[model samples]
Target chain A: IAGITQAPTSQILAAGRRMTLRCTQDMRHNAMYWYRQDLGLGLRLIHYSNTAGTTGKGEVPDGYSVSRANTDDFPLTLASAVPSQTSVYFCASSDTHSTGELFFGEGSRLTVL
Target chain B: AQSVTQLDSQVPVFEEAPVELRCNYSSSVSVYLFWYVQYPNQGLQLLLKYLSGSTLVKGINGFEAEFNKSQTSFHLRKPSVHIRDTAEYFCAVKRAGYALNFGKGTSLLVTP
Candidate 1:
């Protein structure tokens, strides 16, 4: 499909392990975002890229890093995973950084033990 | 910074009954409003949005929301809901060129 795709639908890793959640969009959008969905917390932005080669922090960017070397891919990495980082991660893209609707991927569920 | 608040963390109602999910936001500038629904273990899908037009915005699956600028509220409503409507509903706001700020979310439980 010509939408966002995320890999490793679900994963279990040990604490301090390095992990990466892959996200790619075929829509050729300029804006990409990473959010974590928790039980009570609806969804919080972790990192975002306005365009290729530009990255910015979000409300909860701690413990997470992202790189946007190209327009199609925006991968989020957990340098050293912690149990507190366990949550469902979602990747979304928009046509522009302004008033465009978002298209989201299914999700990547990560569990750190 | 813009923020959203879904007053009711949980709403329980009977099938076929009317329901409302309240949402409020805090922003100093003009913003766009949106409502999204998420099924179990799935990502969020846009339910509806209010950009510039009538305050009453109708969405998919018989859901609608009203944008009350004075009140800073955009509450989701359904005249009659179905079991399929039982899911997590999120209210979000966005300023220009920025990612959305989502509310905690309201879990709607439709019981028969």
Candidate 2:
């Protein structure tokens, strides 16, 4: 289908290690976002890109970084993984025409030890 | 800034019975409201949205919601729910930005 695709559907990493989650979209949407879903915190925005070559932080941006090298890819990296950072990460994309609608990926489940 | 609140963390209902999922939001400026459904082991999908126009908005799969400006609420309703409708529902709010603020989510359990 022509929607968001997230990589590393599930992973386990030791503390102090580095990890990266890959996200790609074929819809050519103008905006993409990274969000972390927790037990009772809902989904908090980690980072976002309005267009290629530009990026911005979201509600919870600490310990995480993102880059929008092109319109189709937005990768999120964790320099030093921590147990607290372990959660389900989702990548989403949207366009001006869709208004507030967001197309989400299946999600990446990461566990830190 | 925008924030969403889903009153109930979980709701239990019987099949073929009506169900209501409550959602409330807080925002300073004009806002857009949306409801999303996530089935088991799946990504979230847009159920419906309320941008502008009438207060009532109908969505896919016999789902609908009313945007109440006075109460700052956008609660979802279904005339009759089925076992297939068991899923997690989320309420989200968006301002003039590309990101959306979401609620904790409400899990609907439709039993036989």
Candidate 3:
């Protein structure tokens, strides 16, 4: 089974443009998350969903929004891309929300110019 | 609130040598700890985790971590390193059903 998959493997967007990064998981997990990885900063949480139809704000959720309409898919959208948003984005899911062990998808690298 | 700290930003070691990556965390309540590794241009993968069990937790790829409640630390260690072990390692903690709080990753470079 494909554990997790992210679409638009790489993208280049001009500043102020809108973009959406798609993520899907086959594990039927209840928890899904969005994170951005930058040099020397590690991965910072952008937003998360405890379960389908329920999303929460994370540490760094300024320019991004997420929706979890179904169990298998969660998408992150950037209303207006900025150079600061240029980073590798990752999607992750876990069988249970309480446990910290996560299954991650190959990242989507976005470059905003 | 929960936070994680990875003491080292970069570690350089020769193959066959033992290596340790230090990690410490702070939380108001009891929490679970985990270590994740990311290879070049790859997603993060679980290396190991500490739940309610023995202090020592062994994981895939000959890596292990010890959870010290008193010290508030979960340091990852491998007895012998290989060239394949070169990657960025992250320390993460979760408190009461919250998403993981990750520390600044430590890049490990295993040289031949």
Candidate 4:
């Protein structure tokens, strides 16, 4: 089953450019999240959505924004990419709001130069 | 707020040797603990979790962990290791309605 799908599996972007990371889940989970993983730093939540049409900012939301228009898709956007934004981004979803097991996507490796 | 700490950044062990990866967390309220494994070029997968009931929780791939409330620790253990077990392990903690807080992660390398 395609539990979670994220695309442009890898990308290289110039600083100040805008980029969007696509994420979709077939499980129809109520909650979805965007997290960035860096070397020596574990995954940090960028944004999350508890359900359709509702979004929340996470720990590191400075350069990122997310939207949840439907239950299946929650995309992250970087308005102005910076060199420090280079990292692997993962999309995860859970069956419940916060206490369910999370299923993660393969990840999108973004390089901001 | 909840935070997780993985003591080891990297661990190297010979094949067939027992291994342990230590994890600890800090939280004022009750917390849920989890262990996740990430292979090269892949997303993280759940290894095990400790929500309640049993202090010792068994997970897939012969992995197990014990929750020590007194010490605020949940250390993963495996009796013997294989090369396939080499990967990055993460420890995470979460409150009832909060986002999961993850540790930096520990890379396990099993050599022949």
> Best by DockQ, which number?
3
lDDT of 3 by residue, B20-111 (tens): 99999999799999999999999999999888879999998999999999999999999999999999999999876788889999999999
Better of 1 and 4 by lDDT: 4
Flag the better candidate by TM-score, 2 or 3: 3
Residue A95 error, candidate 1, Å: 1.5
TM-score of each: 0.97, 0.97, 0.98, 0.98
Candidate 1 chain B lDDT trough over 10 residues, lowest sum: B93-102
- Mark the regions of model 3 whose C-alpha exceeds 4 Å error after superposition: none
DockQ for each model: 0.80, 0.83, 0.84, 0.79
Per-model i-RMS: 1.0, 1.0, 1.0, 1.0
lDDT tens per residue, model 2, A1-113: 76898999999999999999999999999899999999888899999999899999998999999999899999999999999999999999999566957999999999999
Off by over 4 Å in 2: none
Model 1 TM-score relative to the real fold: 0.97
Off by over 4 Å in 1: none
Q: In model 3, how large is the Cα lDDT of residue B22?
A: 99
- Backbone collision tally, model 2: 0
What is each predicted model's overall lDDT from 0 to 1?
Answer: 0.94, 0.94, 0.94, 0.94
